[model samples]
Target: MNETRREYIKRINIVLDFIENNLDTKLSLEYLSKKAHYSAYHFHRVFLTLVNESLNEYVNRKRIERIAAILLVKPNSSLKNLAYKYGFNSDNSFSRAFKKYYGISPTKFKSEGKELLSKIGIEPFSSEKYICSIDNIKQWTKMNAQITIKELPELKLASISNIGNFEKAGSMFQKLMEWGHQKRVLDTSNFKAITIYRDNPNITQTSKVRFSACVTISENINTDGEINQHNLKKGIYSIGHFEIKAEEISKAWKSMSIWVIENGYEFRDGDYFEMYHNDHKTHPEQKFIIDICIPLQKTENIKLGEINNLDLSKYKDNLDYHQLISYMKELRLFFQKEYDTIFKLGKIYQGAPNFSYFSLTTDELKKQKLKFVIILNHKELYFSICLSGQNKSIRKKYWKIFKGSDWNKYHLAESIDNSLSIIDQTILKNPDFNNKRNLTERIEKESLKFINDIKNILE
Candidate 1:
């Protein structure tokens, strides 16, 4: 029987995944059709209608893609053995199928197929030349990333699919948020944006890759639109946490893959996805804190390590009010030192021991008494570029420009908007004064960036 659009997509994906993983085994029409819960006669027609490829053609293409990737990485392996290993009946048949798909003999592909293989999206970086890039691997490891393997629970997601470029997923996410709001289930505690990657970039052409922008939902909710319900299978996953700019995402993925390979983990044939922790728009550097999860083969011999032991001990929650005041003193001193070094202005405005205020006076706006404020509290610690003083009218005049300008670019304070503004970046969640110098550098860099952004906006 033919399935609904959602069912067809879901069942076909299961079959596709099975096909990719079991290319070395027999995958007869009856078997695949039964697995997809369809009668063989209707299954063939349904598969062709949805995937636009005959069952045999689609299976052969994926097998060829997989073989191409393996050959690129293992150029020294026997061609005949490789062909047989991937379920080819004979050398002649394999050669014909390979040639038909790639327009080149396997021998020619191994000898001079780098460009051709890349054109078909089968560029395996495990090739001898790339494997020797020890420096790149070292740099990646130095990111101090702590990767762990864990059993992930199956997630039922409300997802919107996007074909081709993954950049289009942003719009999908926005639409999902709008949908969640309309349904009155948009609480932040449970709601989270996720991206499901459906194709291996190493084997599939990027422009033909499929993905879905999804949000975790408690159960299958009613949806009559393009947004459909999907389930992420529960399995062992190697998750890598990353804090990086958007452009560094591809590098992060590569690094994670390398880490997995180095740590002796085999990748499972299933969906890979990313779950975001913070909004990039709110980050001062526009960096995303994302957890990249890769499904792994579940074997008895594999011993998994700690799953979520990210060394964030430098930020602790037991800070009392006295400790807060002490940490604020350190922050104030550091800010004063930085300002004095740059502008020769020493300890300009030290507000009660809990906060510090520094003045910024350019020739054009000296009367404005623009101050950069740093606040340390038991609950949270943050700093921002704001306006303070008795200059009420001047503050109001500039506040108008600040509000009307690209204020979103600045991290505006959420609670206090009148005299204080733009607390876009938090210096520390829980301060530890023992590592004061390092924390000082981080806050100083962020404070300067905030000042510069505000200056441009005001100008």
Candidate 2:
């Protein structure tokens, strides 16, 4: 992790600790400010900047979350008592806050006993959720599978209007199309389209499903004023082609929503029209091929982490571990020459005591003209160097670290191997460290042994 991200995580942990300790107390701005070691006036703003929520909003939201969880497990619990237990003075005030945040009365929530945890936006406590596994990225990418871009123009169409219940709108569109076909008014070549909802599903009602069953028509083939012309604004759209079975449309929608969030694009609150390219009518099995389009815009402060798309099989036998290590050392030296801040040179060994690993402080690391560290484990290597400061120069220096090499081709494992070798070499040659050579030799021998162990396991 870089310095900025590390500090941000540390601050969040401190804030969480304060919240946990003072959950039952009236947590005021002054108290939290002192706990977070910031001025009272600045604390609120800083907290919101880092966490995307105001202090009072976060505290109240968390309290409501706890209350919802309690209600689920203890359905017969008194609403009034629960409110007081979470630091609310009056039942009326608690109910108002709960309803505002969760869109349900506390009494009704307790009686209904539905899983209100997700409804209230409270995250479940699970270690799996915080594991930050690489598999998550793989699964997400596979489901979203890269889509092709297509530009479509203005379309004209006709449809039935529904008040609410957007999910039903799909069936309504199907009925309208069938009706049109029966009347011999709908042209199969006109292109089927459905103008579905653009509102919050959580708050929207079943009676108010806003939708339009429409189609694209040629200008020359005019219909008597009954059809509406939808000027389909032209822009870049990622179009995914998928055949949705009758029972799996909801799953498709959920996957699309996750893709949008992961890619840092806000869903345009407009009609997310889907084109039914083919349906069961043409092929007896009724496999419906849908073209799903989501509008996207780039926003500041949103960045996706590096995606691993390496094809490891291609380079399984051709990789040069030694050359890669030297290249990484050269890159580290280049960064040291270009940046002014502290750089930490560190080595971490596999299967070694934790105390054996040594890290340079941000101050000491930056003072060195050129420093590197490497850790050797039985079958793996680890390498890390710090480029200090939050300046543009520092960013530019680090950005060049991965340039001009086949670094992009190697997987995460290879990169770590190269990094560890450089760090180990640097620490071994350090004249100030009395036993540098012995330590380095031991690391190298242990790393080879670790590799043998891994090979044996694999075999």
lDDT of 2: 0.47
**RMSD to true structure for each model, in Å:** 11.6, 25.4
Candidate 2, residue 41: Cα displacement in angstroms equals: 51
Question: Tens digit of lDDT per residue, candidate 2, span 309-384?
Answer: 2222333233233323433344335435543264444422111111113233345334432223333211122322
Q: Model 1, range 255-301, lDDT digits (tens) per residue? A: 77777777667777677899898888875347787888888998875
Q: What would you estimate as the lDDT of candidate 1?
A: 0.66
Instruction: Name the candidate that leads on lDDT.
Output: 1
Best by TM-score: 1
- Positional deviation of 180 in candidate 2, in angstroms? 6.2
Error of 2 at 342 (Å): 76
Can you give the TM-score per candidate against the true fold? 0.56, 0.34
